[model samples]
Target: MLLVFFLMVAKSVHRIGPTEVGLVTKRFGRKLPDDNPIAFNREAGHQADLLMPGMRMKWWPIFTVTKFPWVQIQAGEIGVVISQVGRSLPIGAKSARYRTEFGTFTDLRGFISGGGEKGVQRPVLPPGSLVPIHPVGFLVITARHVHGLPVAPEFAALARGGKLVAQSFKLDPKQLEVAVIAPHGTTDVIGLVTTLEGEPLPSGDLASRIGAFDDIVALETDRAVTDAQVIDILMGTKNGLHNNYQDFQAFLDAGGRIGLQHDPLLYGAYLLNPFLVRVELVPMLVVNQGQVAVIKSFVGLPTLDTSGEEFKFGSIVAPGHRGIWQEPLRTGKYAINPRIYAAELVPTFILTLNWANAASQAHDLDARLEPIVGKSREGFIFTIDLQVQIHVPDARAPKVISMVGTMKNLVNEVLQSAVGNHFRNTLQALEAVKFIETREQVQQSAHTAVTRYLAGYEIETKGVYIQDVVFPDELVAVLTRREIANQERATYKEQQAAQTARIEMEKARGTADMQAELAAAQVSVDINGNRAQAREAQAGGDAAYTRITGQAEADRVQAIGLAEAKATEALGVARAAGFAAQREAIGEMPTALVAVAGAVAEGKINVVPDILVTGNGSSLDGLAATLMRKLSPAQDGQPG
Candidate 1:
């Protein structure tokens, strides 16, 4: 029965929390039967099963229950009674009774209340005498103290010499060193010595067995717990300064830790944040209008009409404002450094104009006045008659506002300088005719001078003309006298020229008449000569024709005469022969003879021979003679 009870109680044990475990033992070395008796089962063979918080087991009268504590434990009930052994208490035993409160058991070491102080000596036991004692009674042995009796050297040596206790100490701002405890064995056997005032354990003493008597023992400090409060302070302060208060509080709540180096109060004060104006200008030029006009002055001014004013330094002058004085106005106020700022002149002269006319008028006046003032060898005032035509190429209006002032001064200077001594002398010499030629010469000079002056400035000189001329009072008188004398001389020369022209005209007319007469005479001579030649030619032709005709007529007449002469000779010879023949034929018949003779006389005899040799020739000859005589005598009576 006893063995059964022990087994049941021994099995009715369990552990709580991580650092502790429970062990159960049996009474009288006996084991009981278990519900599940596997070899690995820790609760095998026992009616006292492993007891959890609410688990219950059958408790038999024959079995004894016992518990072996394997680690440290805390009793949870308040005001529970706890018995201390091997610990000395106060003289009043009842008043010195020990009690537990708030789940913690308080030590009664050094609890005496009387005037006579009693010291309790530490009891030294032989090895293994306090083995297997319950921790609740053994752990309270730290309450004992020693007094009165002189300590024996051997016992003192043994008490002081047993195991050495090590301690660590530190001071807070209050100069109180906090004690740290390190334990290696049973709490009842160990001792700690320290110098911290009012500390519960200046010298640590152990009330419970730790290990074997021969084994060296030591205390291990709970560093995490020992430094926890200080680490919390540092972490909290550091968080507050670093703006990490929330994180620091979380760390404390979660049992997180830090070291001394994380303190926030040790930081230094200096810290840096760092920053940059841009300038620009417009380009332009200015020109004068005189003999010195060839030189241009540079004016650094804005080309546009800008509301914002620009300042200039150095040699530049302010356009609208008074020039900066070299001296300061007051002690703290300085005249603006001449090298620092300047006022800008807005460029108003972009419009183009014809300035040539202005210069011409000035030149004419200068010429006329020079002689009148007896200053012909000096400079004179010239009028500048300008023909200004403003041309605005861009949308901007022509900037004529500044031009009026500029032109006035420019004209004055130019006229004064340009009408020099040489110009004056020339004007004086031609004083009488100065007015007449002044416009022409002035126009010429002005065009030349003004063009050169404005060349660099790029201003266009469209044209120039001499509009009018004016002479000084003195010059007018001198010029008028000179003019009268000039008019008289001009009149005399005109009359001489007229006479010379008339004489020349008459000479030319006479010459022309002489030439005409000479031509006529020559023509008459030619005509007469030609007539004579024609007459001679006609006479020669007529003579030749007459000679030829006379020769031809003479030849014709000679030929006819020769032919008639031969015919006449032949007729005479034939007639004589016929007459002879007829006389012979008509022999001795008076009538027939007469008839034949008449026929022969009329030249009609047909057969008459000159020698009539007929048969009766001789006889008939005589008869014919007689008949012819008779016939002749009869014809003589009628016609023979």
Candidate 2:
């Protein structure tokens, strides 16, 4: 009865938080048959099953309970799980997909039974929401950010296949970021990948594409030494999606081809798995200004039938593929894989091809080429300075590159050889001395002839400049002597002409002196005769003036008398007409006088009156007073 009571008291109870989980362990439990107590078992030591929140029962001082916070993951983060206790993982992606025994990390019993791996987990716990878990059951750890792991140097020794050579075969988080290949500068280059994992590269192919060349899987695959390998190769090419190689999982699922790609990477930085792919940076074929690059593909299809045109029967190719392309790459940058095509840069400018010992054009096609020397008809050994300007238009640059390989090749092989042979043969037809005089004609003929020849090679000869025609030493000396003799004869002839001109000039001067003396004598005689004639003419003019003056005076008096008489008669006639008109207007003389007297009376002047009247003054006053009285009555029209 007392032991039973003790047993009831031993049954102690405990509770857990709302979001928390309880990890309980039996102090004493079942043991395996014929063996000591197991450290971890279903009914022993640490129980695989976890206690739920808010409830728990345990024997007093026997069973133990420990509470743990749930796992919380924020946005844009992941929880990389590490199994403290579990089995190993299978080989591929779908191996641990349908889990019953290892039913995720939530259920410790299922996880133990599901055969989960003990190392870094393949699947990651995504962000958002908390995950309640037991501390003893499974250790739930966040990604590298949540927990600060030690960083390994990027210069860590790498394996032969480009994977990082792990220290003593340990799996670390740094191993996850195994390989990366970033482009350095603005130079264009392509990534050549050779995968060491996956299924072996197809036949002769050395690589494959799983996701990106630097994908984790690809890195893992590349890291595969014979012991721990996955796929052979994952290429950086063949993806219509996945934001470059950032989405590693998507790349692998897409099943990209693994090998040397046709298209190349321009200027940019890139992440790469060195173990998954071996990359070699090759320079781009640059087509500079005034030049064109012909692209000739080495791989693909059979030969095209170009026998009738610019190409031979077996050397035919399609444009931009198979063989030499008709359209060339203009002056610009091109990210072409050097392994696939051959480039021949043909200058499209007017190139001056020189064949002279001292020729120094910056665009010298062949610096090692010597000057052109030919034999004259007289067997004189002479050297010719030849400069031919040639141009290959944009339309024909491709044909030029294909036919003769390059501009340098054309200058060395076609232009130099043909021009040398033609000049050598034509030059022998003329003497060395005659070369200077006939140089213009020779240049024209050569230009015309070379143009036709180079037309077959698609090069147009613009012009040919004859810089110099150097003769042998002996021939030069002889020509100089002949020129001196010719100058001597010319000098003698000019002196003779000068002497004859001088003699004629002296004779003309003597004749001019004698004529000067005769002109002076004639001038004096003419001066004396003109003075005499002047005096005689003056006297005759004076007499004529006097006689005309007397006649004018007499005529003046007669004219004056006639004018005075006529004026007097006119004055009398005008006075008479005026008086007759006045009488006609008035109708009576006495009435006209009264009208005049009335006007005088309106303007009558008053005389001073004296206290004592003088008789003369009285008379004058009486006359004015009487006249005014009479005129006033008349003006009033009253009869007096």
lDDT of each: 0.33, 0.58
Give per-residue CA lDDT, model 2, range 1-640, as digits (tens).
Answer: 9997677565556687887776666777675333211135645566666668876776656677667667675554445444544554456332122243443478755665566544444344555647765454443344233321111222223223343323323334342332233444865555443322233334543223343233332343444332112111111234345334323334344554445544444444343333233345677667789987777765433445453563542344434225665556677766556776677777787777678775556666767566788998999987888888888987777666767776678878888889898889877998776776788888898999999999897677889888777889999898899989999899888888888888888877776877877688779778877887887788779878877987798789778978987998897688556645765777545654554555467765333333434565756776667555644534544323
TM-score of 1: 0.20
- Per-residue lDDT over 547-614 for candidate 1, one digit per residue giving the tens place of the 0 to 100 score: 88877887888788888888988986886566556656764354455666676788765344556455
Total backbone collisions for each predicted model: 40, 21
lDDT of 2: 0.58
RMSD of 2: 34.8
